[model samples]
Target: MSSLPADISLDTLTPEAVAKTIDHALLRPDMTVDEVVEGCRLCARYKTASVCVRPCDVRVAAGELKGTGVAVGTVIGFPHGSSPASVKVCEALAAIDDGAEELDMVLNIGRLKSGRTGEVRSEISQVVRAAKERLPGCCVKVILECSLLTDDEKVAACRAAEDAGADYVKTSTGFSSGGATLADLRLMRASTDPATTRVKASGGIRTLDYLVECLQAGADRIGASATAAIVDDLRARKASAPSA
Candidate 1:
């Protein structure tokens, strides 16, 4: 939704070779409306691809960014995907109503680990249905907390998210013990079918180097609180390079 051009075929935005890899995240649980408004404003000012925030402020963000192209996104199950199916649906519906253009739901890690892949898949599908029904045309990203899963489980989750109709398979909730790793990103990137799915790298990504790495590893988007710093770093690097 960011006006910065999601497609990089022409490559005119940033020259880091991966400007699209950075998504400006504002998922503070206690972020106030005024703060969200300001936070989203900052994301737009910096030309971030998207702004991911808590559900409570999705509508406010959407309203604030009508023409900015900066997408409005929110977390569904959030750090824990253990909520019941009904609960996740309600949250997704509410977030859409509040103007979220995208939903990032946490997968039921426990259920998946407990051999409840069916239930996990169902939960994600239902949430996706709810989002699409409400938004009509929108995207849904499922957070798998990849650090906790075995490679096989990660692959299974990626496939499940794809089958469940999620637009992207995300790395973490930023509340986990670890965050996106290059290895995990690569594994997931290759695991998901690129034709119908994407990889979102979030959680502990706070540098330009990491951002570039995420993009090269097949990340379609990034979730970071350090958006300004990264962009500034890109600008600085460009400014210091000798003119050809």
Candidate 2:
């Protein structure tokens, strides 16, 4: 895993690993049920990371994807992580109530940027605690809106998430000004003592090349809106290449 000073080159990644890392996504508010159906179907076929959708559809998604390794995930503190910690926990409970198997929650970056370390950890811990208590065995991923933070602050956020018992520390909510970066992912990987926290890269990774770079930079999961194209590109390259 890459460590602090996250600036890795894209050349480090492999096409095979890239194919396994995408979280096939469709979180747009205006997304129709048909589009979601299409999205979910494609995700299942590709065997991508997860099929992230709105909180309301967790039960349906979980049901549709029964026995599939594909996970039913939803967002909390969503595009904005500035809400009261209790509110985000409640939202998590609601999503879980609907059959969510994994959670992708945005951390309170504003507080962390303001140097409120304890509060940041406290907020994350609340969600972690609630998830374990209520859902038991489900995964909780904390998104630390990387574009809004400094490198050191990014490291600190990862630590906080780990301390809070979060299963993963992720980058971006996709609503921020910028998205994932190799520098951030590498730094996050370095900050951990034991790799109890996996890294997730979300937002703006639209191409197969970008996704490859993210995986090489030590991101275990990727949240992308372009899963179809990325997978198709991989298949085309594979078919055209000489047989091994």
Candidate 3:
């Protein structure tokens, strides 16, 4: 867990602080183009870190968020991590071309389960290369879907993502049986080189309490579809608090 102040209070939770930690998720399969556009507007209004949209919505999100200071991001290999290395690479490239500044790609769960760690690393490396090569500032996050892995497997996946040059190691794709957990976030943060890699917690985290717990667990970013409500709660609590 991060060394957050033991007595952290609502008074200290500014909108910018909350917003910077969020990656407004817009990845629901049934989400319409208009919804994605509106989501981008919300992201812009909140000054959130980015909008994590479906691959097909990257262009639209990028257009909607233009000059908003919030980045546009998309998923690669999506809820499944079985896509071929070449396919993942193409997906990364296309997303970049469509104006994505960040990519969250799922690692090959099957390969990792089968003990083909090298192949998993190779695939992550390919996508990382494609994203970084095309856009030097683009960041790639490898989703390990921690709910399905043993603690050891989770560690191994984090190491593999680091070796493959990923900017962050994320937990869950939200389509999985479980989402990010504090234990997983702590393990991921401890496993990686903090200077080079970060941790992102996603899935099943909708409330402000869960968001704070994830951050204290060392998560640098969060993926959530309930961005507006959470931040609104944060603001409301801060406003209702007695003056210090």
Q: Evaluated with TM-score, which candidate comes out highest?
A: 3
Encode model 1's per-residue lDDT on 1-244: one tens digit a residue.
Answer: 2333354332344743344455677777677788888888887787666788887777788888889877888898888888898999999988887888888999999988887888889999999998898888788999999888999899889989999999999999999888999899999989988888989998898987777677667787889988778878878877887788
Residue 170 displacement in candidate 1 (angstroms): 0.4
Candidate 2: regions farther than 4 A off: 1-19
Question: 237 in model 1: Cα distance from truth in Å?
Answer: 0.7
- Could you list the CA RMSD of all candidates, in the order they appear? 3.1, 3.7, 2.1
Between the candidate structures 2 and 3, which one is better when assessed by lDDT? 3
56-168, model 3: which lDDT tens digit per residue?
99999989999989999999998888888899999999999999999999999999988889999999998888788899989999999999999999999999999999999
Tens-digit per-residue lDDT, 1-244, candidate 2: 4332334343333344454577777788898887787788877787776888888777777777778778889999888888899999999989888888789998887899999989999998999899889989878999989998888899889999999999888888888799999998899888865457788889899988788778778888899989878878876777686766
RMSD of 2: 3.7
Give the lDDT of residue 138 in candidate 3.
91
Per-prediction TM-score: 0.91, 0.90, 0.96
